[model samples]
Target chain A: MDNTNEKLGVGLLYNASLPEYLEHNIEQVDYIEIIPDMFWSDEGRNAYPRFVDLPQWRHQLNWMAKQVPLVAHNIGMSLGTLNYFDKGYIQFMKEMNESYRFRWHSDHLSFIKLPTKGPHDHNAGIAIPVPYDKDYLAMLREKISFITEQIELPFLIENNVYFVEYPDQDYSETDFINQLVSTNDQANILLDIHNLYANSVNHKLKARQYIDELRMDKVVEMHIAGGNEMGGMYMDSHAGPCPDEVWELLDYAVSKAPNLRGITFEFHESYFPLLRFDGLNKQIEMAKAIWNKYTLQPYYHELA
Target chain B: MNSPDFQLAFATLIASPQLCKQAIADEPSVFDQFALTEKEKTRLRSVLRQKGMSICCSLYRMNRITPLYTQLTQTATLLGDELITLAEEFWESYPDSSLQFKEEVLAFGQFLLAKLEVGTLKFPYLQEILRLELAINELSYTPAIIEKTVHFDYDIVAILLAMDRGTLQTERLQKVQVAYKVYLEEQTLKLALL
Candidate 1:
């Protein structure tokens, strides 16, 4: 969804370690994408004022909001969750948008929270991939429609990294995404290049071919990350700095995605030592180098 | 047949590799609770057969324990190898996690306390470590200015430092009973010996 055609330029997914990095190298960051769930502790489904702000995290966010454009990359929505949609979460995001003025928001096209009859829902602890079937597509469309209605900003759906694939599915991942984005002009894609790489290595599929099949124009943002091999499979660990192959794929993806607004580099906070400030700056520089080649001149470099 | 049923089954399998094994063994009763279609059952059964299923379970375990280890570092360190068995037992008993960091950390702390009280899990200084970590965690999340005193039968600060340095000598540790104050100062958790 093109809420604003203005490009977001290079972005970094905010993690626990970025506070130190941002202290000295804030200039290197064009934008900061925050996972909002990290900034608060939800007491439960039944607590009064359920969302309690983490003072330290909020203090950091409040400062960052003034320095650069802040976009939200949420993990809590679990939008692909079947038979249940978290309207309260969407409402909270609306409140967050009011506070941070997020240019756009996105979440994975997977389910993490499994609702039950208990006092609290069960968290799957990992993003479980949604089956690419018509029923799921319909469910996602309804949920996205509800979200966009509640929050007018552009909403992007990130592709999932699957360790195992369902045997029979209605559509390919690309086909499912294309169909989902067709729901409305406000719905779009956040393509993750490393997820494609992990899937390619594990499932022995062509990453470029998957990209080729995707509707590139719907790709409003792209995620570049690194992964590690685990249990005889390439896992999308987001370990640290992007691999050479992912940068190459990002180069290809940027070339094809004419409407791309942002390129986010993600790494887990625990790997901060592996990606010291220098490593982070290099990733940003490389993404900007690719972004500069394909995007128009002088995009939204900072919040004005 | 339905997505929720499939999701619940998948989530159950992730949380319990025992059930994943049961499903892999083609034990029909493993998924009897879910009203799944024959195709759904077959797909889940096939998924359990894949090597990636092990990865899935392992990843789930890693994620599940992250908040615990990150928030309760000293307690986790003290538990060491015993954490694996204790965590599995805790999950088996208290299967649902709110996924809230505060909730998970606190829940695990309470679970350990219950185990210690029941004499199932034992350690000389486990209670002090768990209680100290729990207090710090609670203070970190407490928005209002609050203070609480936690009493330790041993020198916890030295023990935690030794634990961090990997030089803890349980027998040589000081047996001084001390009270440490945990409170929030300037939005950060602070600890002081009183």
Candidate 2:
């Protein structure tokens, strides 16, 4: 395959336990997404205690940056809290960005920590859902601006899965997203295709129409994954193979978003047994075939 | 105690003290909102005043007595009924044949039944309750009837029952009991051995 003709790339979100050279397997894929938080802590069994310090991880991450663009997906920026953003966290992220020099950085657009009457709750790191309202939008804009100021890189926000019940809100999901993008002209979006599909299935909405209505020009990346069904709802389980609906939605979204930079395959080791890697490879082939079919020749050549 | 409009008056008294007092002092137009007849409203106001006074006196001493005593009593009764049902199900599912294994199984069942009476077992208590039942299920297994017999080897069955009880007591039940303040750690420890 002509490297230039491959405008799209398949890449794994780097897992620390996986040998660094595992990147070679999906090397044919265009770009790799590295989760900075995974490297932030040196506690896990397979994790390199000095992964952030190691030249190979840094050099290889940067090499991956040159060979194929690298994007930073973060897990710790609690964007939805009333409390001030963690300056230490922002500083750490700045240091990492300086070391690897990623194309962009994205985090979930939901709160993880809250103002409690006790010690800052560290265990409350799970992404929490926020109501779509004017007040919430204002809070999100301030947080996003703060992050953008610290990183100097374009900030992207990914939509999240909400498991708990929330009181009725005035705005719909599309309206909420539209307002967020419009408020921050510099903001980019990471559209998790499976998350959108899961939300549509759980909430009973037209998934394709939700994608159709989005400001696609603002979308820079897409995420696809599998979910487990729990308590009459599908938990965004990230544990299995992508459903056909999600793949079809991805194809439709690619056609819609002309500026989509890359697609990431997010796999969790805990649920690795449930996934069919062969099926995932076939999906990638399907995505590339669709990209070839729809992408205009001039843009394709320019990417080449 | 048997006032025609007692329910309406009681609801009003519980909801708003100011409204209840006004209603007692002089029937108000808001009483009309309750859709009570003139006689019924009078009867309701009289009974509400009596009940409200009694409640105030009860509350003054309620702290000295056991809080939620009525609720605890009802819960214990319901749990006891559930335990009996579970015990009956276990017996029906596994008819006793061996004297030693049967006694062991019945002893475990009795332990659970005792715990249920204490009102310490948490919701979705079936899994733990069933483990005790399964341990007793050994009596149902007979080695001589090999052609159509349930396997209940001593080590395998004992290990499984131990594992199940350990998970139930330590992992599932303890986490819920602590999280929801359903039972104290001391109380849970006492029940665990059972």
Worst 10 residues of 2 chain A by lDDT: A42-51
Error of 2 at B17 (Å): 34
Which pairs of residues have clashing backbones in candidate 1? B1-B37
- What TM-score does each of the candidates earn? 0.95, 0.54
Instruction: Write the residue-wise lDDT of candidate 1 on A23-77 in tens digits.
Output: 8999997889999988987877777787888888899999999899999999999
Residue by residue across B1-194, what tens digits does model 2's lDDT show? 12223333433343344555676676775576665655455555555455223332232222211211221222223345564444434333432211122333444445554655676654444333333234323212221221222232122233335454654224332222111111123112111210
Docking class of 1: medium
Supply the DockQ value of model 2.
Answer: 0.02
Best of the candidates, TM-score? 1
Model 2 TM-score, all chains together: 0.54
Which residue ranges in model 1 land beyond 4 Å of their true spot? A1-3, A297-304, B161-167, B172-177, B186-189
TM-score of 1: 0.95
- For B6-108, candidate 1 gives per-residue lDDT tens digits of 8988988988899887776766777788888887887887788888888999998999888888888888778889998888888888788767777788888
Q: What CAPRI class is candidate 2?
A: incorrect
